[model samples]
Target chain A: MRDFDLLQPQHLSDALDALAQNDSAIRPLAGGTDMLVDIRAQRAKPDVLVSLQNISELRGITRENGTLKIGAATTIAEFLKHPELTKHDALRYAAYVFANPMIRNSATIGGNIGSASPAGDMLPPLLALDAHIELVSKNEARVMPLSDFFLGPRKTAKRANELITSIQLPVISYQSPVSSLQSPVSSAFYKLGLRQADAISLISVAVWIQRDGEKIRDVRIALGAVAPRPMRAIRAEEILRGEIFNEMNLKESARIASEECSPIDDLRASANYRRRMIAVYVRRMLEQAWSKTQ
Target chain B: MQKKTILFSLNGEPREWSVYPNELLLNVLREQEFLTGTKYGCGIGECGACTVHINGEPILSCLTLAIACEGKEILTIEGLAREGKLDPVQIAFLDQTAFQCGFCTPDMILMTRALLNEIPNPTEEQVRDYLRGNLCRCTGYASIMRAALDASVLNAHRSVQSNEE
Candidate 1:
């Protein structure tokens, strides 16, 4: 890694001040799992590294106003251990199979989302949950929908001096108790990686469905690694919304999900292979989601 | 470049060191502190050869910045044995012949210690999951898995025995 000035801020405000002072020349360091790897591989280099480990405001999970707020610096281990996240199968599955135990202990959700990788395990499920990010800077703070946060591969809408403070996700039925007349959330996430452990996803799918008995009232399907950025399969979702889970709808939605993606051929998988796997995985995830509703 | 000297507890001893911002904890342990038990398998975080305990959690030292070690307690493989007595995991590994080349032993032992510290009795799947990050090309994972299970029982026995002392 290239040598750079290290700024250790004792507070979140101080960290923001350091970022504002250094602008694009500085990068915020959270768990350093992704950032350190990028720096070592020479994929990223900055004049200063601002450490956020000491920032208390950026470190825990909370629920307020019917939303789940996860601090940007909360490690993947911490998030997975949270009682709320564990009960949500989609999030738990993603957390369980993400990277490995050691990496999970050191990688943060904020860094995962902040890195803006299409293959990020946490993004698709979070996107399926309709999560939004909270970005803070010295001057102002703003919240952006998670779907709109990513601009491209390794790119985001966040400004240079901005620090991601928290990720707020809607408290869906899966995260709360099922009340009378309230349709329980049925969600599932599937990742197609080369190997079971320590492999990046070639293609991944997540589905969030709220069914009124056998009819799907609402559904959100999110796909990852099949696009430059993780995206919702809007066309596929539209076909399944207000429709019953059947062989025909499942096949059509799966086809639409595959067709709507924009994947590229990489060493891990060919673009054609990813598209096919996307269809298969989408069908599988939808089946899993439907089974949960029963 | 801005440099800072930070104080942190290492293996139960307080130490102060001046380090560069980009210096990784793996390099600092091996070079500055001369603690080479933490191996460097891959410079990136993929390989867990540099696994160490930071505040009772297993993390990749290669990915952790040395300057970030301020005020935190770090435990390396060298810290496992105390007063010439081997850790239970080490004893179990020896009895079960868990390693062959021994290249990944330090990381394996430390990872098991961390696991047993949290879960005294782990299921086979849990043991495999926790040790998955520490790759051992020599043992084929069978003996390692056996050793991990035995270590849990050995550790539990040792704990009960110690509590009575």
Candidate 2:
């Protein structure tokens, strides 16, 4: 690996200053699981390395005003341990199947999202949850929906001077148990990997739904590993939303979602196999989520 | 390229090295520190052959930068045995013959150490989850799994005996 100056910033503001000064020449090191791999493989060669380990503010999970704020440096293991996060089935399940215990101990959700892999385990769940990223720079800061944060594979909407501070997810409230007649919000996530652990996704699906009696009031279906970016199957969601989630409708939505993706034949799986698995996984996720609402 | 004095505790001993920022912890421990227990397998984070404890958590040393570990406490396979006493995990592996080629032994032991530290009595599924990254080509993991369970029991037994004394 080529040598670079490691910059250990004492303050978050100092870190932002260094990033702003060096621009693209500096890479923020979080977890070091992904960054170190890229550096060793000659895929990334940043002249200066900015270590964020000392930035205490970017390292915990918090909730306020019905919004969940997870620091960008929070590890996957930390995400799994949060009591409130575990209650959200989609988020909990994604964390459960993300890599293994070793990787999760160091792999941060921010790094996972920043790497912008279309097959990122957190992307599907974050997309389904309607999460937003808080990006801060030396001069200013801004927040954007997580769905719009990814431009393509390994590409993000973040500018060179900006550092992702936190991921904000609005807590979805379920119908009160006292109102037994009202429908409740439910979600589910499923990933199809080559092996049980540490394998990247062949295809993955997540669904967030709220039902009114037998009809789906609102729904969002996110698919990964079958596209250049983790994306919502908007047309499929449109078809399923406000419609009775019967066998025929659910099957049709799944078929549409599968057909909408543009996947290539990769080393892990074939494009055709990915499409089929996407359909199957999406159907299963939708069924599971629908059942949970009942 | 820049170099700095990397100071950290290695196996409970203070160690320092003047090295490049890009130097991997696995290489530094094996080459500079002359601690070769942690083997380099995949060079990437895919394999846990170079797994070590950073302040108590198991991470791939090959994927970790030496300079970034300035203040962290590192625990490798060499640290498992202290004052001529073998760790229960080491004894269990010896008794069960957990390894054949023994290439991935240190990694497995260190991973098991971290696992049993976290979950004193873990289920079979938990053991599988914890050691999934550490691959063993010779033993095929059956004996290793058995040894890990035995290690848990032995550790608990040792703790009880010490407490009684």
Candidate 3:
């Protein structure tokens, strides 16, 4: 690694002040699972490194005000271990999507969201759960819905001085003891990769739904690696909302969702393969989620 | 260079040291502590060859900064045994011949330890998923699975025996 000035601020205020002092030349550090890799690979080099390790507000998981507020620096392990997320629909789904134990224990959901990789495993779930991000700076702080946070692949609405503070996810605590989803909604996250582990997705989908009798009440569908950023299948979801559960309709919706993706042909997979796989995943996820509702 | 003094617990001991802001925690373990069990396969986070348990959860040491772990409990493969006694998992691995080339052995063992810590008795599918992070180019993980399950059974037997006694 190239020599760089490292600054560790004992408090959030100090961290922000350092960021304010070196606004353009500073890059804040989180879990560094992603950032360190980028730096070592020569992707990014800032003159000042503001380590967020000592920032107290950037850690922990809490359930308050009917929302699960997860600190930005909270590791994926923290999110998975969070008592509330496992109960909700999308978050529970996202919690199980990532399989690598090391990544789960170290990679922060904020860094994942901040990195804005189209293949970010948590984005789909956060988008589905209607989560919002708190981006804080020395002078100001702003909140953005997870959906609007992403600009494109590897891009976000984050300013130079801004640092993500926490992600607040609205908890879906509604439970029907006499219903199929009594045991936290059954979720299926399918990411097609060359190997079962350590392989980035060629295409991935996260689907979460609430079943009302024979009809689906709230259906969320998000796909990654098939678009520039993790994107919601809005039209597809719209098609399923308030619609009676049917395999045929689900398959058709899958096709429509596949049609929406602008996948690129790369060495990992062909664009055609990704689109077709997206359809397959939509079908698989719906079938799995629908079966759980049953 | 970005250098700072850090205080952290290592293998159940507390100490302080100076580390580069950019230095990976794995490097500190290898260079400072001389704990060579934590191997480095990939500098990036793609490979799980440099995984360690930070505060009871398996994390990639290579991706972790030395300064970030100032006050966290870390468990490397070296800390598995107590007072020279092999941990049940280690015994099971040795008994079942879990490794071949052994490059991935330490990571696999630590990963298994972490998995068993959470899921004491994991099914084959769960084991596969839980051990998904660590890679083994040799042996295809057949014996590794056997060893992990065998260790669980052994631990269960010991627990039951202790209760009975």
Candidate 4:
């Protein structure tokens, strides 16, 4: 940890002003779980750290106009504790397995996204939820889809002067009547880590499906650690969306998802292994989500 | 970088310390406050060796900055005992011989206390899941698991005794 100036802003506007300093080295410090480690390893050397911990405006979960708005500073522990979030199983499951209890107690949703790691546990679920990120700077504020936010590993579309304010997720009801199966949205998340807890994902998958009668109304398949960034399998999604819900279509969708991701051989797993697991997990998640819809 | 004084309550004592922006809470506690019970096993957040309770939640101190501790209530392993008596978790660890090397004991005990605080009597799976971050190379986790369960029972007994009295 090299010496750096610390700016503790009690207000979001103050924090934004601090970041608005034109200096690219001025970085917003959320949960230090990732940033501090990077700093200790000398991977990230920001000249100034604008602490967002004190900003009350960027810390909570709220629902407005059918959107689940999660403040960027909301910790993983907070995410799990929120009663309303339990319905979002894919996001909740991801939060449950996000490192160990201690790390989760401190790690923030925004920090996870801010790190923009390919293997970030929260990425796949957020992508599957079709989350929109709200970024605020001194001059202006903007919202963008989570898919377009990530440019590469540790890289994002967020400007140097901006701070991520909140993540907005569309609320979909998963508990519609089983008889009619009217607009019941179901989702599932799966992560193949080295160990049960405190392990980074070797490959992760999240599936979100909305059923309309006997057909798939809308569907999203997001894969992590199998690409340059957490990405949606659009080609695979196309195969299942608006199509009749069946085993054959699910298998084809899974196969296409495996083909769409360009995973590289890493220390944890080989590219071949990741590609195969993507197909397997995608299929499993699809099956799990479909069953939930019933 | 300019050093700033932060005021916070540590182990039931309110103290002020001037620290650099880059100073981690772990280093500040050990060096500035002389509360070395919070061990520094891994500088990263992976290992829970530097675990401490801020506002009653266990978090890795290694990854937390000292300045962030301002106006927050911090509880370290040294704060667990009261009136010269060890905490229930500490007593259970001693009875169970939960540690062989004792390097990870402080954090393990802290985590168990925090766990029991949340779930009065947690199941074996829950205990393992909750304390997974606090890695112990010794004892193979069996004794630690026993200690966590025993601590829950001890806590129950203590509460009962207090209720009766």
Predicted model with the maximum DockQ = 4
The lowest-lDDT stretch of 10 consecutive residues in candidate 3 chain A is A179-188
- Residue B95 of model 4 has an lDDT of 96
True contacts preserved, each candidate? 0.84, 0.78, 0.88, 0.96
Cα error, residue B163 of model 4, in Å, equals 2.4
In TM-score terms, candidate 1 sits at 0.96
- RMSD per candidate (Å) reads 1.9, 1.8, 2.9, 1.7
Instruction: Report, for every candidate in turn, its global Cα lDDT versus the true structure.
Output: 0.88, 0.89, 0.81, 0.91
Residue-level lDDT of model 3, residues A247-266, one tens digit each, is 87898889999998899999
Model 4's alpha-carbon lDDT is 0.91
Cα lDDT for residue B84, candidate 3: 94
TM-score on B-chain, cand. 1: 0.97
Candidate 3 Cα errors over 4 Å, as ranges: A21-24, A63-66, A172-188, A210-213, B157-165
- For residues A1-294, could you state the per-residue lDDT of candidate 1 as single tens digits? 688888888798898888886467799988888888888788888888898888899988889988989899888887578897786678888988888888999888999999999999999999998889999999999999999999999999988889999999888534335555444677899888898788899999998888777788899999999899999999999999999879999999999999999999989999999999989999999889878774
Off by over 4 Å in 4: A173-183
Residue-level lDDT for B26 in candidate 3: 90
Pick the winner on DockQ between candidates 1 and 3: 1
Give every collision pair in model 1: none
Docking class of 2: medium
The candidate maximizing TM-score is 4
Q: Tell me how each candidate scores on DockQ against the true complex.
A: 0.81, 0.76, 0.66, 0.89
The TM-score values for the models, in the order shown, are 0.96, 0.96, 0.90, 0.97
